[model samples]
Target: MSGHIAQDWEPVVIRKKGVAAGQRRDEKAVNEARRSGGPIETIKKFNAGSNKAATSTPGINTKKLDDETEELAHERVPTDLKKNIIQARTEKKLTQAQLAQLINEKPQVIQEYESGKAIPNQQIISKLERALGAKLRNKK
Candidate 1:
């Protein structure tokens, strides 16, 4: 019947169970050993159905290159393409830097193409052809 009713309030504390102290110390030691690159014992579980070869090492490159792939690996811009680029650029009276600016490319790119050191790029070749009014690709 009172305007305000009084009630008892009780505070309760709850604690969560965590890893045991010995287990935590063992984990810390294992982490430290891994960070320091020290050898650690690896336990391999027995699996009867695992088809993986036990003697094979992981991440080893076992691939052998074929003749075609080997040739492609050493491929560069053709000498003819380099000569054409140089000739067209010179006939236009454009310096390497000036031609590069006209094609919106770097001067080093023009130099590389002229020196036959650049890898063939069709898009850049097309841009150069349009800018210099010449055909740079080989005819089949």
Candidate 2:
């Protein structure tokens, strides 16, 4: 079966430029109209959904934000207090289901707690602290 493999020295013809078949459109008029436009005119429709990426991709770096985004953490509250719940659960080595079982609550309730949709009051907090052995409130 290996005898059919092409030789390594074979010349591979690569097309370096020009549009691909079934996907070419005229953009000269669009360029001319843009050249005559005034400044601050919103430039162009960068993302009208139907538009596909073409020759003009104006490169962008898409690395994930890796900074100490703690400054941006507050916004996650209510939508993110669930993080604290997850943390507490992990520290206790308990799954959401296990935690819910201990607390007489539904697994979805634990999810809601973690999602910041349901902030537990003193009673629930105490139950959680007992269940997970964590300090969840101010020490006053």
Best by lDDT: 1
Clash count per candidate: 0, 1
lDDT by residue for model 1 (55-137), tens: 46654444432223534365689998999999999999999999999989999999989998888888999999999999988
Q: All candidates' lDDT scores?
A: 0.83, 0.66
Say what the RMSD of model 1 is.
11.7
Clashes of 1: 0
Lowest lDDT sum, 10 consecutive residues, model 2, at 72-81
What value of lDDT does candidate 1 attain over all alpha carbons? Answer: 0.83
Candidate 2, after superposition: displacement of residue 100 in Å?
0.4
> Which residue pairs in candidate 1 have backbone atoms (N, alpha carbon, C) closer than 3 angstroms, thus clashing?
none
